[model samples]
Target: MIDTEILGWRAALVGELDHRRLKAPSVKLRSAQGAADGEAIYCVDLRVRHPNADHYLTSTELHSVEHFLLEGFMRLLPAHFVSVGIMGCQTGFYLAFRNEGRAGRLCDTLEQILAAIEHAREVPYANIEQCGNYRNHSLADAQRVAREILARRADWLDAA
Candidate 1:
């Protein structure tokens, strides 16, 4: 799952962030547009479709993916990137970094992040460890939910 189409849109959003030629002391993740610092801040918006309306990805599953994605990125992405958290909307993730290098890099970074998410789905709960605030969710459920979310990404994003 992990809708390639919607993923592409997400990547484009990342690309839009990356395309900006920003200055240093950059903002990482921000809730809105405009410069806080010379550095560029990446804005993320996650919109969950039919949240609480359907029994698809339970609250536990969504939070699990949020934690897993953050933990996975922390372990995988370059240290230059900072600020990682789930959107308050409980739909997607947010990541911001001080673009010390370039802009378009966020696209590649996001690709890597997405790939890690897909790979993480393959890991068994017994093998994966908890690294986020909540620990009640399992890797299996996380993977399942990730697949569902990604598969329905268009519907999710369109719902936004």
Candidate 2:
């Protein structure tokens, strides 16, 4: 079952984002669809499927990583864009921007997100108790999700 520890992680992420300066002037979460919804936006998907696994990162972890990545993106790629958030079937976290013009900017951001995941793998997540589903997962499990997602993303790049 999905855990509450995951939610604590979400709160931490939100807190982190609140403290940072995002590159995009406008970023937000929504349930709508279309270009107007994502135009000039920097979309982030906390819920990414692994090519060969049924398991996925808990929503809390995804949201936490989104916050971590958002800080990195603002620092690394400050291109103008919008932000959109959504709840995914497996998990939910996003920052969608408008148009395909920001693809290059997004690639750079994605790279940093992957790097952060790798770096956090060995680092302890003392924030577990504060996450939405603390009892459901562990640092080890988060690391596994990171490894699996990173590998899948790499494969995606190679295939593209």
Candidate 3:
């Protein structure tokens, strides 16, 4: 069985966002559940802003970043990766993974992904054949956001 209290504590410490203000880029573990054979499924929130912040990502920027992040995560952790998706609020992303052990290296892995995005020449899979809104993407915007997130590397693991 899963420990609800522990999960709550983890979310409060690492994922809770102050709704009244803006926040720097951060990666937080939002949830984790055990699966069969001792494996676990984890969902992480990658925030670029606080929940109530008026600012949000443009659709183009979001699409570009999503393309890069989805491709990057898959390339880096193919066996463990589940999905990468944009938040409905447009403040950040949700990254899911399935693994057998503690995901202590998730922050490092995200850093690597962001770094690759920063240097990427194009947003992966942003073609008409691969995306629903293929024309709505901006590699430059994605790189800019990646840089912003990477700049906050030291704070990615900070507790709330």
TM-score of each: 0.51, 0.46, 0.85
In the predicted model 1, the residue pairs found to clash are 2-150, 3-150, 18-103, 26-39, 28-96, 28-97, 29-96
lDDT of each: 0.45, 0.42, 0.75
lDDT of 3: 0.75
At residue 21, what lDDT does model 3 achieve?
Answer: 38
After TM-score superposition, what is the CA distance of residue 38 in candidate 1 from its true location, in Å? 2.9
The top-ranked prediction according to lDDT is 3
List RMSD in Å for every model shown: 10.2, 13.9, 3.2
In candidate 2, which residue ranges exceed 4 Å CA deviation? 1-39, 42-47, 50-56, 84-86, 98-104, 121-142, 157-160
Residue lDDT tens for model 2, 55-83: 54566555555445555555555554355
lDDT of 1 by residue, 1-160 (tens): 1222322333223323431232221212223333556544445434333334333445666666666656655665657556656545454455655432233354445445544566664432323354434445666766665565455433432322
Candidate order (lDDT): 3, 1, 2
Error of 2 at 108 (Å): 3.1
